[model samples]
Target: MKPVIRLATAFSILATGCAFGAEQHVVCPARLEPDAVQPNRPPSGWQLHMLRPVYLTEGGMLHGPPAESAFLVPDGGTSRKVGKQSGETQHWSFDVPHGYTKWMYCGYGGGGATLKLFRQVAEGATECTLSSQSADGVIKEVVEFVCK
Candidate 1:
């Protein structure tokens, strides 16, 4: 089945070319298979932390550890950076396919990982809001925004 990329929080799928009327829609979701991927650097074996890894066989991202955790916010969120303690960066880059609306992500932080979805833009790629959720379900932090 084609995975539906709902906001999981919001109700907008901009990739579908639909004017959201407070209802979420579906566009194709990216196939994020790690085993089928080639590394841009070396896999850190860390959770959800893709190294200068090649995403979707097109682009590659390199990360440097973040200082404080970040989150994807509403109404104007675009790319986000999550930091690690080992001077390593837990970066996220989306090379979404055409007709793809939402970018579905499932990640967990060791201490607590921040999750963000890049907001949309007219030119180039837009980013989503960043929300924080821990791996072990022990902690939950506030979801930050670009405005505040």
Candidate 2:
């Protein structure tokens, strides 16, 4: 009788889809535009680093500067597929470093673009879309550092 009850309980748990597994959630950060004037010019001890346009592929890596405080990632930030692929273009996702609540993305080739920040709940990782519009076929990285 005890065995039967245990089996029923297990079945019920499985039916409810309560299986233990890592679930990912998106953490939205404060997005900033290129022309947006932030009152806090010099955010504490942080500095601005201008990254040249880096041609990226589907699985390529967009390396951030290795400084005292880099919101983006210095290395190991892999590109991920987001939406459907059109022509020879593909959308990629670059995970930002944790603890960074603010970021700015400026596109040179494109007219204007938006920066979307996302955080992985399972791994607690923060990331953003590299570029939504690549008119000249290049995406630039703009990073503003701030003392956390």
- Best lDDT among the predictions, by candidate number: 1
lDDT of 2: 0.26
Candidate 1 local lDDT, 1-148, one digit each (tens): 1112233433234343223323222221132333322234443553333333222111111111122223222333234334421111122333445654333333322233232223332212333223332222322332221111
In candidate 2, what are the lDDT values of residues 1-148, reduced to their tens digit?
0001111211111111112542222211122233222233445677543233222211111334212223433333233333432222122244545543332222122333212221112223233232232223332222211111
TM-score attained by model 1: 0.22
What overall lDDT, based on C-alpha atoms, would model 1 receive against the true structure?
A: 0.28
**Candidate 2 residue 64 C-alpha distance from true site, Å:** 13
Q: What stretches of model 2 exceed 4 Å from their correct place?
A: 1-31, 34-37, 41-135, 139-148
Determine the backbone clash count of candidate 1.
Answer: 18
| TM-score of every prediction relative to native | 0.22, 0.21
Q: Candidate 1 — which residues are off by over 4 angstroms?
A: 1-15, 20-22, 26-33, 43-70, 73-110, 114-148
